[model samples]
Target: MINLYPVLKPFLMAVEPEAAHRAALGLLKSGLAPRYRHDDAALRCEVFGHVFANPLGLAAGFDKDAEVIAPMLRMGFGFVEAGTVTPLAQEGNPAPRLFRDVKNKSIINRLGFPGRGLEYFVAQVSDFRVAQGAGAAADGMLGINIGINKETASAFEDYSRCLSALAPMADYIVVNVSSPNTPGLRDLQSENMLDALLAGLMAVLNSLDIPPVARPVLLLKVAPDLTSDQRAAVAQLALRHHIGGLVVSNTTVARPEMLAPHLREEAGGLSGALLKDHACAVLGDFYRLTDGRLPLIGVGGISSAEDAWQRIRAGASLVQVYTGLIYEGPALVPDILRGLTARVRAAGMAHISEAVGADIDLAAPRAEAAA
Candidate 1:
């Protein structure tokens, strides 16, 4: 498919960020979005028991309500994650919540987890599956990212509710505990609270009537601002609970020095090119702390092939993109896949999985100590 984002760039930039996002989604839902298909055997890898066509995936925020999964999959991503959907719909934060620093290729959004809630989200997914026939997700995997409502007194209730409602249709379920825009959401990452949260969620999963083979794997999304100690605690808790995987390093609260001064003070998590280094650093930390035992999905500031390769070598079995799509558009998926295919051949590796953690030595004293 031809890349039309270049022509659309000027117009998209002229509109407000949130408006531009809605326009983009409307285009996708209406089948106006361009589609690209590039599937290379070298790019295939197994993650969380499912074999993904490639390591690159669309991160959760883009399809916040599961509206456009099929269109995105047709655009060449190996997988697409939908929703940070809550049990109940929310309007999210006030307007002006999404801000763009075009110069730095970054965005700051405090748009909490706004969506049509679980019932609406589940209905959309079910319709997608039915339309695709029995082989839904055959082209690419589907992940559902679940989150809590703004006023929920009990986090477990919200999370478990979402899990029960969405897990049946998801290839995997991501428990999002790291969105900075949601009030007190980050606090759940604390060791004590996280321990309890994971335990309760696991219990709920075990109680589900789905057969063992069909049950979706559970993953946790964490913040990028974790201290070394906090990272260690999370790693241990994940191992203890037998969690399926971790979406390493969500958007950062810390603004890079290179970010535009005015954009720096925006009250939200920051993502884009400026976030690449720190997100990779956090991915490396989690890899070492977990001793590379857990699968990690690297995301944040990935707009090119080299960025994806760096995350793979740094210990991410898979990587995802959100902000990168805003800057690079539909062609980004094929571009990265082609680059990765080349990189894998140049490195003399048969498949992309061989390059995972190529940059880290799990036997190092620090890693051993962390473990």
Candidate 2:
């Protein structure tokens, strides 16, 4: 597909980031966005019991309300995770919350969980599944990422409500306790808090009327800012709770020294090229902590297939992108897929899964020392 982003980037850059996002969503929903499809035996893989067309996904913030899953899937993402959807509709932070660092190819967003609420989100997803008839699985997997409202009295109440409503429609459900924009949300990542939260959420998952085999896989989206102790604690808690996977990670609040000084001061999570190294380091931490027992979806800088490949070797079963899209456009999806296919062949692997964690040795003395 011809990339129009180069032509459109100037115009999009002139508009407010959030407004441009909304317009892009509107265009996608109207079927005006370019569509690209990629299917390669070498790039296919299964994670959390579902087979994906590829290992590349569009990360959560891009389609915050499940508005364009089909369109995004058509654009060649192996999967599309929608929302950081709250239990109630929220206006999010305020204007000027999303800022661009063009030179660094990064973004800073304090747009805390702004969405149309669970009811509207569920309806859109349900309609998408219905429209796909019996062939929904062929279109690509759908992951619904749910989060609590800003003023939620109980995170469990808000989370369980979203889980109950969206699980039936989701191939996997991401409990997002890591968005820095939401006050007190990151606190949920604390060991005690996360343990209790996971216990409560697992109870809710078990109680659901859905059959165990058909139940949506439960995953957690975490931040990249955890202390070493916090990371170890999280890994232990996740393993103990039998959570299906972890998205490592959400955006980071820690500003990189390389970021433009003005953009670095933005009060929000940072993502994109500036975040690449730290996110990968955090991802490697989780992989070692979990000992590759849990599937990890790596996000936070992946604009190229090389980035995705590095993530896989570092133990990401799948990789995702959002801020990268702002710079590269939809053509990035196919480009990454083609590159991955080549990498798999170069590595003499028949399938992408063979390369997952190829660089990690759980038995290494260093890993044991760290443990």
Candidate 3:
């Protein structure tokens, strides 16, 4: 029997990018899958106060809104992060916003933080609450990716607004200041900028009658293009403010040498194969810097079981993927979980946490040195 997906993707890619995304969401919501579920086994674990069935999670920018939660949950990822939702729902950048360099198995996208606003998303969370028994909610980690608006003058207010709305609804909330697509967004990673943003947001989080960090984790996502000093600064900030967790990367603005012709000219952050080494390198560095004091959501260029395990071993207690799914489809989720379990067994570890930072030498904390 001919597999329908291979025949469909080419044609799908031929259509407008945003429209095809809608169609994919519809298929998932309608309970369609490219293959049958091979693993219904629960792979639960506790992390950041919530119980995650598996370390696998859908990365941000995949479901910029919670439009396909029920369907994505049915596919078996332990968690799904919806949105990078902003304060306002706006159409993203102009067309050709998404591109596939199939030869390199990489994708470049400038889908500027497009989202349906926090108010709309809170409603989404309520209407589509994943049963704590059979969904990302039940598994212990349903994240709402938080971000600022592309045109907003006060990015801090944008983040604060989203946090206030999502704190009660989300299992954990991620503060995204790392997407390269939004001009000046990644600049938030600067020490002064990050300090200001997190300080403002933290005030709001503390005031929440039910803060997300009341076992509600605040995760920070970042761009991969940071220098060693910048990475150290982020670690210091994360430690200083008690950031509950982190997503190691958003996407890369740097186009590596392996990129094919015209690949570099495209405007957007790059993900997939090209990002593998750099992403891992940064994770390793962060692991060394933090000394295992923080929880991290590893992301970028993970397309295989080995890739996921590498992040786990590097210090990420959890992992997320976006581009890999675009290229490989739904089957990728289970493959990651099964691979991770096998890797754990091979390492002769009884629990996944034992495998974290196994090879990375976590040096002393940066704060101690500064003091």
Cα-based TM-score, every candidate = 0.97, 0.97, 0.91
Encode model 2's per-residue lDDT on 281-313: one tens digit a residue: 788878888999999999999899999999999
Q: What is the lDDT of candidate 3?
A: 0.79
TM-score, cand. 2: 0.97
Candidate 3 TM-score versus the reference? 0.91
lDDT per model vs. reference: 0.90, 0.89, 0.79
Q: What tens digits encode model 3's per-residue C-alpha lDDT throughout 202-246?
A: 778888898344546788998889987899899999889888878
Q: Give the worst 10-residue stretch by lDDT in candidate 3.
A: 34-43
List where candidate 3 sits over 4 angstroms from the true fold. Answer: 1-7, 14-16, 34-43, 130-140, 211-215, 363-371
RMSD of each: 1.8, 1.7, 3.6
lDDT of 2 at 90: 92
**Whole-model lDDT, model 2:** 0.89
Number of backbone collisions per candidate: 0, 0, 5
Which order, best to worst by lDDT? 1, 2, 3
- Name every residue pair that clashes in candidate 2: none
Backbone clash total, candidate 3: 5
